[model samples]
Target: METAVADRKDTLDVEDLAELCRALGHPARVRILEFLKKMDKCICGTIVDSLPLAQSTVSQHLKQLKSAGLVKGEIEGPRTCYCLDRERLDQFKQYVANL
Candidate 1:
């Protein structure tokens, strides 16, 4: 293996925060989080009922959550279920605590 020099400076703690914050930047996502937090877990279509936005819009927000690792989704036959990723949430919280 070859040794490599590492940068001693230039860091952005906001990378993770930026990803998460961007995913949550929309009002739809904020509502989705609230709904999921209340139920703790829910089917994909179930999220549509809680928000005034279109189902497709809600799906996009869910996609953002998935990308941010804030939510986990899996197919169940013809439906999809979503639930919080507690690990990521805890990690993010710890990041905030350190700041």
Candidate 2:
């Protein structure tokens, strides 16, 4: 017999979903994601300027998002450029939709 969509464990990685959810738990993170979505790539300072949060706080949020695989960052000279990991974001969306 076929299992229901919600009961199919193979449909999505629960742990990954949980991590992504946690990464997006904060409003700052969500706004950062939205900003990254609009721009092809941005530096840490640019993101900090866009939000009212301090540079260190924004960095922390970026770190959490990066750890969750939702964002990608590359070291460029003295700054780090960031962009959304579209593939991972899409996967997370799919996982949520599957639930």
Candidate 3:
């Protein structure tokens, strides 16, 4: 229904929505984002302890989020610190707001 607004600009196709939704479709992913948002930034170990998911599973979800340009993680020592990609997130916010 809200897609009518999107139609006026660049039409958002299923692939685009799928990528966005896929990155956000899981409860674990949502939790991860929420935690990252609250903490501002956290390491892999931090996110692992914050949720019940295994380290590998959390890493997979993080990868998906990164691929969607919703999150970013940088390697530092043996751990990777993760945070929201604010610029990309703002783009997403603008897209939704316009829609």
Candidate 4:
């Protein structure tokens, strides 16, 4: 049936969803996402200040999130401003619901 085929197509799209999951596998990354969700955008130093992590650790987590397309970063002068990619976050939620 067409419905079954469509379901198959969605299943085939799991690779990206899996990458998202891996990015979120760490507790620190999840917390980073939650923090970003609350703010419009913030620099890496602000994120470091909010968490117990060192700046470099926080930067690494942000990098992973950005790589997974769950976060977006824009360079502003000396800092990189970070925020949740709401569309991708929604897509991740949809993927989980489908599973």
Backbone collisions counted per model:
0, 0, 0, 0
Q: List the residue pairs that clash in candidate 4.
A: none
Candidate 1 per-residue lDDT, tens place, 6-77, comes to 222114556776777787788888788777778888999999887888899888889999899989998999
Cα RMSD (angstroms) for every candidate in the order listed: 3.9, 2.7, 4.3, 2.0
Candidate 3 lDDT by residue in tens digits, 1-99: 568777754545445656777788899988888888888889989899988888899899999999998899999999899998878767666666755
TM for every model, in the order presented, reads: 0.82, 0.88, 0.80, 0.87
lDDT of 2 by residue, 1-99 (tens): 357765576645877788899999999999999999999799999999999988999999999999999999999999999999999999999988988
Off by over 4 Å in 4: 1-11
lDDT of 4 by residue, 1-99 (tens): 999998998777788888999999999999999999998798888999999988899999999999999999999999899999999999999989978
- Whole-structure CA lDDT of model 1: 0.81
Give candidate 2 misplaced runs (Cα > 4 Å).
1-12
Candidate 1: worst-modelled 10 consecutive residues by lDDT: 1-10
List the lowest-lDDT window of 10 residues for candidate 2. 1-10
lDDT of 2 at 61: 97
Give residue 83's lDDT in candidate 4 (0 to 100): 90
What lDDT is obtained when candidate 4 is compared to the true structure?
Answer: 0.92
Give the C-alpha miss distance for residue 32 in model 1, angstroms: 1.1
Best by lDDT: 2
